[model samples]
Target: MSASATTRFGMLHGTALGEGSVSVHQYLGVPFAEPPRRFADPIDWSAPFEGGVRLAMRPGSVCVQPTVTAGDGFQGSEDCLFLNVWAPAPSTVPLPVLFFVHGGDFLSGSGGEYNSSRLAARHRVVVVTTNYRLGALGWARLSEGRANWGLKDQRSALRWVRSNIAAFGGDPRRLCIFGESAGASSVALHLLSPASRGLFGAALMESGSPIATPAGAAEELAADFFRHSGCGEAQRRGGQAVLSCLRAAPIARLWRAASAATAPPPGGGFLDQRTFASVVDGVEVPARPFELVASGALARVALLGGTNTDEGSGFVLPAVKRPLSAAAYTDYISKLTLRLEVPRANLSDVLAVYPPRPAADNANSRGNRAYLYRFDQRARDDTSEPVDWGVTHGSEVPFVFERGSWIDSGNTSFTPAERLLSVAIGGMWAAFASRAQPLPPAAWPAYRNGSEAQLVLSIREDATAPPPFRVEVPPRARECDFWERLQALVRDKEQRVAAS
Candidate 1:
């Protein structure tokens, strides 16, 4: 074969990554900088690839994470700092770009699972998936452990998109960032992180946020995680020895270690409120994003946020702990309401109004303009093992991409309605990326403080608000009042003592 023949067959991006392909164009894996032996490296702003060359096919490697133990579909690797882009074979209308940040509680999950076929095929858009450090590699903060390297990886990916995506027939200015779970939470963090301010225009947070975890608790979790790996011998102070051991050892061992975290199962977790999470490393995070949001220190970007009907039910099974009964829910409201510091009367009325789903509830229900939806559709996996997980954490993802195929010979059959809903959801997302607003009919309403108004979308064509749509926000959740009363009581006691 002549040199011309090689040129015609293979796809090449820039000179940085030689040449590669995966069922399509010149696929290139451009290394922006040398990855550190430890967790993350400084941002690599070097321009390794010349813009405009056709990118070779194949999605980027997923940032390394612990491997899956059981037959469950989880797997990972360390050489995962790659990013992949898919566009219409040969079009140049400056297509809208979609960047995905995979979710695994900032601990696991890769960008590999999400298929780009539907978005690339149906809407004529470019879809990019990237890998970021996960678990300890991404966010663990030992006395000397790297902090927010995963988030820095995200920033590097965005810089890559801004600089080169336009050459691949994508609009650099028109970008939509999407993620589920930790990815979603990362999106929230990005919104608040000044370093990530201009990386994306619109945002879609599936079921997580950066504000959920406090920094002090997260560092404690990292310290415990390292201790669990039996790394007390190293004088480095950081858990680097443990990190190095896990990185060098078989992937399974790391997964086992991560799974065996001293943190208990179910509610008590490695990334729970009381556990380690992406830390507020002064250099990278600066401050908790949730605090910024509460203080209105957020980017003025159009946002869309919502959760599944059983948001927390999948991770937390009631079978282990007794199901949350009505009385338990009442107790929950009384306690949480007190924490939020809402008036006792408001707590009673809000609890009376919103349907109690034990765990499934919206996070940002009031004081913002967010498009909200509840996915109630259930699916049955083709295999004998039923997939009746009701609106679980990841239930809506496959639908959005129609993973395998639609022809159901057995249990795996996506009805037309399901397909429509998926397309609508994806399309709505695409529309939001293209325009700041949502698709019509399903047009979402801007949120108002203490209001019950929100757009409730389902697979059904007609979009309507489910009765008592506003989720129940506990009073204590809002806790200043409690503090004020305690201070007042202290002052009164002091005054009486002075009188005596």
Candidate 2:
């Protein structure tokens, strides 16, 4: 295999890997946008490189972000708008292209964290992973309509791929954008944004919803951020002066101020307003994303997504480290149960679906059928954190990327079952990119109205056979019913107030 690949932008020197029947040309750290100004949107700059062979052997630097948790701080240039690509080395025809957005809660993550060479080679498709702005710098709302630079960065990267993937033997028209967690939420929001239409024909979001902050909430957060940075105090000096002060503030100082302002989620919940992830900015995000999707405004693209069996487990892992007692478990569950807003009498019902049953509401309302699945396979490695991570948030990422060995399960090797699951899941994702349907062996079912059936990806234990999976209905249908009823009541109350 050659050590380099030629792109119109420049001759890229990259590493080559052999997987299955093909070789993968893995190129890392390619820029797609110019260095973004503080609080400004990313500027598209994918011009062809005139320089000699560019070494894309390493991932580009991640954007600057403050340390939210221990061992989670990363620092890089503000010019972190870059992307990585993995393509089948020797392709006879153009293959389907997949653009991936990484998940880091809109705070921390990089396109360099994932290596998609195996997925590209095994599926005979091209895979692209990208990095966008994060935290305050990426999501802070400015005086004008400037906001959601991270999302804008993603849009620019997609445009770059559409224009250049053909050189890598990829069909731009058949592109699919997929991601996990915040990345998933970004993909979901893109579906609602006119700016993102036609950039990708389909989407696959994992464990996220298009829940952007309301305009008022976004404004409040921005104000708090300014106050924390002492920029609000500078307003007496004039509005322009405030902007200049913030822009001129050192990156570390800005990071600290932003980190201090954003409050952590209370109780056991993942939504954080101060994180200021996505916003309902009229330009980039035209309207309330859920309403837009519900009205069928953006329904042409196919959608596929689902939460894991223990999606909430990741949020509470830190609390249950020392082998929880019955009372402790109940306390943990109660704090989590409050988020669902069901009656205390129905708490049992809500707890039954903590993993959240896969619903067809997002796709079904648009009269478009979608596919849903529950990734319930628990990893055998539990040594990283003291508690049970149990198919927690972003747990499926390793399998999807076909790098099961990379997961820090404290184990150096994978079980036969784990390896098989990785191959199967990765293959399904590849198949979806190429055919728009996950080719599950037990016959993946297309979601239908009232159909809680989903492809459950779990290791089944049988005395006579190895662990494998089969079709199953959502864990608890009654729980889903209860929540829908509860949500309807809340919606009715809001509508009545609006009418009044």
Candidate 3:
């Protein structure tokens, strides 16, 4: 069936489909921002489009980035600023809105990769997903003023949503921004950004926290890009000249250089995945993230965050041989260190902290309440590659979208229980959007500085039923504590050194 809605931009025609219990309005390939110019801010394009019945049945083209798989290379255009919307088909009056940003280390992936039909249809909410600039085109900050085009694009999309989502039966005031991985990082940065305040009321950060890149690192990457893209030859001509030359270069040539320059080795540090990340540019990200949080510079919003049980399994395990020996684990930890030192003590501390089931034992001291959860559902498929792929990074995404069954066959052979789990998780997200609190099966304590209680989502493999779950106590308490202390110590040292 066809579903038509009257938006400020005009009339939009979307496809309608029914799931088990809910009907959904699916609008795809809707432009949210103007086509991007290389290394430039995104411009608003709402006023240009003449109001008419626009068909939004297909996903828009993704942003420019290197082909992740073989046979396809750099397969997108500069004019790839689009978004998709999924609202309840039966027209729920003034439903809460959830705006999503996708994650691919700021280099790859698209908003279209994650479909929110299941979420909107099943939960009776409005879900929007978007595509922004990526890789060098999205990043590559030549100077303070021209950095982070991707972030600018996202903000523009948010502005569009604020102005137009009422047409889709969405409550602009109750909007919540949520994302996983790099997308989650963006959410965190937005929390710290003055530019992003008042855009959304709540945030759900899954496996991502703000880890702003230092100014020097960003500048260094800029220099590397210039050298690699042959823009350094124009060094004497000034920064704007160099930017112009790089923009004029072939997209392929620029992409290859960016790929080669930022690609880190396997088992790399936390900063590796963040090579093309947000920068601490004075305008966008004014200060250290933790400092911003501690100083109460961020908006007062409800936050929910958690990491998978084995966050490193998918990325690090496949590259290593099976039967990961103690030596190999130690070596892997060493390679994962960002600083010159990965002390034996630190290794032992990390090993001690990240066991399958550590207890949660801290209460939060901050004023705003945050809910923390650990996802621990292991796919039942015995033949799944990376024999040790146990709740790795990005693994929880399928569950959140209720698309666990649709993942690559061999990757995740979903059991009936897993599907139930998906329903539970999706419901929690929807409930949070609607009421700022998760529904049943997700009822748990808010995170506190020293609170030991945690909400764990795990399946009962021994139960005869399809999928049975329990809200177990927090896990990995000590490990998280160690990291927290380490971060505090590091922050103190950096501040002291900066003062000096």
Which candidate number would show the highest TM-score if scored against the true structure? 3
TM for candidate 1 is 0.70
* 1 or 3, greater by lDDT: 3
What lDDT does the true structure give each of the candidates?
0.56, 0.74, 0.73
> Would you give me the overall lDDT of model 3?
0.73
What tens digits encode model 2's per-residue C-alpha lDDT throughout 1-500? 45676666777787887776677888889888888887776778756666757788888888886554665345777989889999997788889998999988798888887878877877788999999999888888774467888899999999889988887789998899999889988988887777788998778888877767778888888887888788887756765787798898887777767876786546632233257688888778766665566566664677788777767667653543356567555555666555443434333323324222332565666665577777887665555666666777777787777676444342335566676777788777777877788764348877776766677787644323433666777656766676556656767798899999
**Model 1 lDDT per residue over 1-500, tens place:** 00100122132442112112312122334443346455556455353335423354455556655455744233555666776665554564787888888876676666655656555666667777777877666666654335777887887888878777765667878898888777877887787777788888877777665543446766566655655565534424543565565456555554445555634657542222233357777656665553455455566666776566555445533223434566545544455444454434443223222221111122333233355455555443423323334555666676665553323232326566665666666677777777756655334455444443444445553533222223333333234234335546766786799999
Residue 408's lDDT in candidate 1: 20
Q: What is the per-residue lDDT of model 3 for residues 388-450, given as tens digits with 9 covering 90 to 100? A: 566667777878887654343324355667777777788888878877777443457665555
Among all candidates shown, the one with the greatest lDDT: 2
Instruction: Give the poorly placed runs of model 1, Cα more than 4 Å off.
Output: 1-33, 42-55, 58-60, 69-75, 143-145, 228-276, 318-369, 380-388, 404-412, 450-452, 460-500
The alpha-carbon deviation from the true structure for residue 173 of candidate 2, after best TM-score superposition, in angstroms, is: 1.6
Residue 394 C-alpha lDDT in model 2: 71
TM-score of 2: 0.87
**Shift in Å, residue 399, candidate 1:** 2.5
* Residue pairs in collision within model 2: none
